[model samples]
Target: MFKLIAFDLDGTLTQHRSKLDQTNRKVLEELDKKYKLLMVGAGGCERIYNQLNCFPIDIIGYYGMQESVMNNGQLKIVRSDFYTVDKQYFIDATDKIREKFGYTDYAGDNVDFHETGAVTIPLLGKSAPIEEKVAFDPDRKKRAVMYPFVKSLFDGFNVFIGGSSSFDIVKERFNKYNALTAYMKEHGINENEVMYVGDDFGCGGNDEQIKTGGLNYTLIDDYRNLGNKLAFLL
Candidate 1:
């Protein structure tokens, strides 16, 4: 029996960049009774908390770089970590990478310099209109073509195909595996007791680490079916 149920927020719980609906909310309410509910998100804890309409649940954000819990009847960040990047190095490296990949011409900012050092080389830049970003990689064909090359280029860092238009690079020691492992260690919960649900579990995907961590995992392909898919688990 699964004692803990962790979920990926974006694609697994709701449509990408969309809000949780009443049906899923009710499903969550039902699940809450049977297992621990945790939201493991690619974005920040505060954003996740608000996006869920401030639903009551623990959150693992920024791929585990940040953690938060419902505290004082509100979401509170229990831990926060940040890494400083050599901006000059990033600027120089980003330019070179673009040139090598023939991405010299693009829109908006070339590099998304996040406070957490998880660099995003957005093909259409961070400020690109949603339509173009959506059109840029509808099938992830372009990103996949360059995935291996970019992965090798960032040899010392952990790289992943993230969002619809960018690559997420994190520190070597940080990932879903590290995040879940640390979470379990602190909570005294073993792998078998935790069931992880996510969409991005294929190779190079954000949830790959956790899916392959030898933990019980459920793959959620479409948010529309998530309620029915997880009804049995909860």
Candidate 2:
């Protein structure tokens, strides 16, 4: 029997960067009766928690680099793994890749440097028009074309086709699989007793690896419909 349920925020539980709805929130409150609820988000744990209006739950953030738990009265970051990278090196490498791949003309910044040293190469550039960001790589063909090359260049790092038009680079062994596995170990729970629910489970999608890694997963396509889809589980 499933003892724990981990949720992916966007497109599964809520709209992208949206607050939880009453319907789903009520579903969760009910599910809390039999299962330990958790969130596995691509963004930071604090950000995810805040977006949910600070609903009480454990969060796995930044793929797996961070994890926050609800303490007695406040949220506590039980884990914060930071890996550094050479900024100039990343800038130069991205520049070369852009030119070589014919993405020579971009609107905003090419590389998004994260505080934790993780990087996002938004193929459409950082400040691209919203319409263009939505249109540029819907099929993911553009990014997938260069994913292998970029992965090769950034050896030892885990790369994911994240968001609408970017690649997320994190330290190796820092993906959701690692985070969930680590969380399970820390809580003295069995991986087999947990089920992960997410929408992005396709090629290069952040959730793809975990699904492919032999984890029990429920694929969600739309957030609004998630309640009825998972109502039986509750």
Candidate 3:
């Protein structure tokens, strides 16, 4: 039996970058009564908290770069960490990758820089239309082929095939695996006593490290069926 259930937001709980629906929200409310629910996200803590409509639950964001907990029905930051990055270095490196992969002609910004020193290499450019971005790589086959190359370029960063058409890059020390383990340690819980539910657990997927890192996890490919996937827990 699991003592805690940690969830990944985007693909696991809802459509990418969308708010949680009333259906899933009700499921979560029911589960919350039986077990602690946590959201582990690739974005910032505040972003995830807000996206959930400020649902009162702890959040580990930016792949563990930040942590926030709900206090008296409100989310409060408990801990956060940011890494310093060489901005020019990323810009130059991304350019080389783009040139090598024929991604030279993009719509807007070549790379997206996050506040936590993380970067996103949006293949179609940051300003690309949403429809095109959605159609860019539905199966992720295209990005998976170049994942190794991108990962190699970002030597000290954790690279993942993120979003619909981009790669998320963060400091190597920050990742879902480390974040979950650290959370377990901090809460005096055993790894086996926790279950991670996420959608991206395949090759180059953001949640891959958690599976490979020897953690108990459940996969939910379609966010619409999240409630059914955790029916046993309910």
Candidate 4:
């Protein structure tokens, strides 16, 4: 009864920022024959495309801020949305959180301002080593404790516990739920006809909105088990 299968990239299909593995890739190949596949991710469309090694599937990126489709064997971004943020405001706001939480020291940059207007407040600094970031909050406990405070500080923006040690902020209108719904409306697919798969559905997690929004979804706790988690579909 399903016509589409959407997925989260990192943590669901592969390790964070890692390439798609052969097992999942083969699974996708099989699924593509029967249902449309989409990559709905927190990163940009192009980045997701390449990370998948250009696996020919439509992609919705930046939580709906961007859209891309396969064109002549290449992924072409067809739509992109950008918002202007008060840079100084974010800087000052993040500083306040850092000071209150005693995260006054960090490596690289305090916050990453993406071109799409999305913002990442890296708690350990953007340039921190991968190992350190991964070890900082594997269970998201630390981020959860501060999630509400971060949200309070950024009233107009949607805040999510992102990556290994950071918060991803975007406008309230954009999220995996809204993005998936918009795609369904455009393609004439019903809410019941699509299934989303992701790993992060915990509080403040990036995929929490979709799970809470009443969409049909399956959770993959470990990327290595993605094949088994979705075997029923195959």
Report the lDDT tens digits of candidate 1 across residue range 6-63: 9888778876666799888988899999888998777889989887988899999988
Superpose all Cα atoms of candidate 4 onto the true structure and report the RMSD in Å to 1 decimal: 1.0
Among residues 3 or more apart in sequence or in different chains, the pairs in candidate 1 whose N, CA or C atoms overlap within 3 Å are none
What's the lDDT for candidate 2? 0.83
What lDDT would candidate 4 get against the real structure?
A: 0.93
Displacement of the residue 229 alpha carbon in candidate 2, Å: 2.5
Count of clashes in candidate 2: 0
TM-score of each: 0.92, 0.88, 0.95, 0.97
Cα deviation at 73, candidate 3, in Å, is 2.3
Q: Give the clash count for model 1.
A: 0
* Residue pairs of candidate 2 with colliding backbone atoms: none
Q: lDDT of each model, Cα atoms only?
A: 0.82, 0.83, 0.89, 0.93
> Which of the numbered candidates is closest to the native, going by highest lDDT?
4
TM-score of 3: 0.95
**Model 1 misses residue 12 by how many Å?**
1.1
Pairs that collide, model 3: none
Candidate 2 stretches with Cα past 4 Å from truth are 129-135
